[model samples]
Target: MTSIEPITLTGKFVTLEPLSQEHHHGLVDAARDGDLWKLWYTSVPTPEGMAAEIDRRLGLQSQGTMVPFATRSNTTGKLIGMTTYMNIDAETPRLEIGSTWNAASAHGTGTNPDSKLLLLRHAFETLGCPAVEFRTHWMNQQSREAIARLGAKQDGVLRNHSRSKDGALRDTVVFSILEHEWPAVRNGLEFRLAKYSA
Candidate 1:
């Protein structure tokens, strides 16, 4: 089965670098921006857990089931979050883009959209993926909205999808953008970024 490889993806607002131990401290600071770990529905790690999270992602990469990236602000050149291509099915040439979180300060900026643009471009044009999936906890309305803003259609809700760190049942909301839908989504992202550019 073919697998996605770790590679740097750059854009005007953000850059997705292959996740590494070197990004540890920067991510800690980023997580501290909004005390992101306090959000119960998400899995943003605390400062001390940053290294372990990086290790976990790297371990998955080693197993050839995931390709992770540390998101960085192109202007500040600081690590702002993490994202990944996971649940890889090389036979179907599909993957899920999740485990993504950005610093609160980076929210509402062009960072997220630009990052998605770069990722989707790579997944479709480079990786030749037929579909890219996104999943978020149902309680995480903000995340669900963000994914929708990217032009992905909600596939459905997975009830009792998994257990959260807090031991609460999580309803997973699934969204996707098929290969045929990429162009329109790409154009929307471009238009969104252009507004920020000006």
Candidate 2:
């Protein structure tokens, strides 16, 4: 199944590898860079919870419901974050790219965009998926803007979509890019990446 495959996706700035225990320490350091776990709307794991989080993701992978990745920086050769193709529906051929977080240092450094380029390319070109979804907490304006920057259109908000780990109700903002729209999105990503190279 397209959504269940474990594969590496490489880009100019980042490489997406199958998440493993070996990435545990690097991920802890990356998460600590910005104390990302402090963000109320996000589910970023604290250093102490990193291993359990990895286990959860791997468990989901074993169930054929998610494909997780450890994102490593090409320049630093360091794990900077994690991402995944989750909420997978193989029959519909759709997957949601979620649970993504990066080190503070990797922000605005071409890491995010290039990583998206690779994921989007794989989802559309390799997997032949008709659409891919992205969801974030409504309170996370940074993530919403970043998703829009990748040429995804807002699909609407799901009020009280789910309960967060802290027992708070989460309003999820969903966005998506369709297969037919991939060409334009690809062009936009390439154009954005060009600026970093320049």
Clashing pairs in 1: none
Tens-digit per-residue lDDT, 128-172, candidate 1: 999999999998999999999999999999999899998989899
What stretches of model 2 exceed 4 Å from their correct place?
Answer: 1-3
Which of the numbered candidates is closest to the native, going by highest lDDT?
2
How well does model 1 score by local distance difference test?
A: 0.92
lDDT of 2 at 122: 90
TM-score of each: 0.98, 0.97
Candidate 2: Cα lDDT at 188: 97
Regions more than 4 Å wrong, model 1? none
RMSD of each: 1.0, 1.2
Worst 10 residues of 2 by lDDT: 1-10
What would the per-residue lDDT of candidate 2 be over residues 1-198, giving only the tens digit for each residue? Answer: 534589999998999999999999999999999999998988899999999999999999998889999999999899999999998888778899999999998999999999889998998898878999999999999999999999999999999999998999999999999999999999999999988852
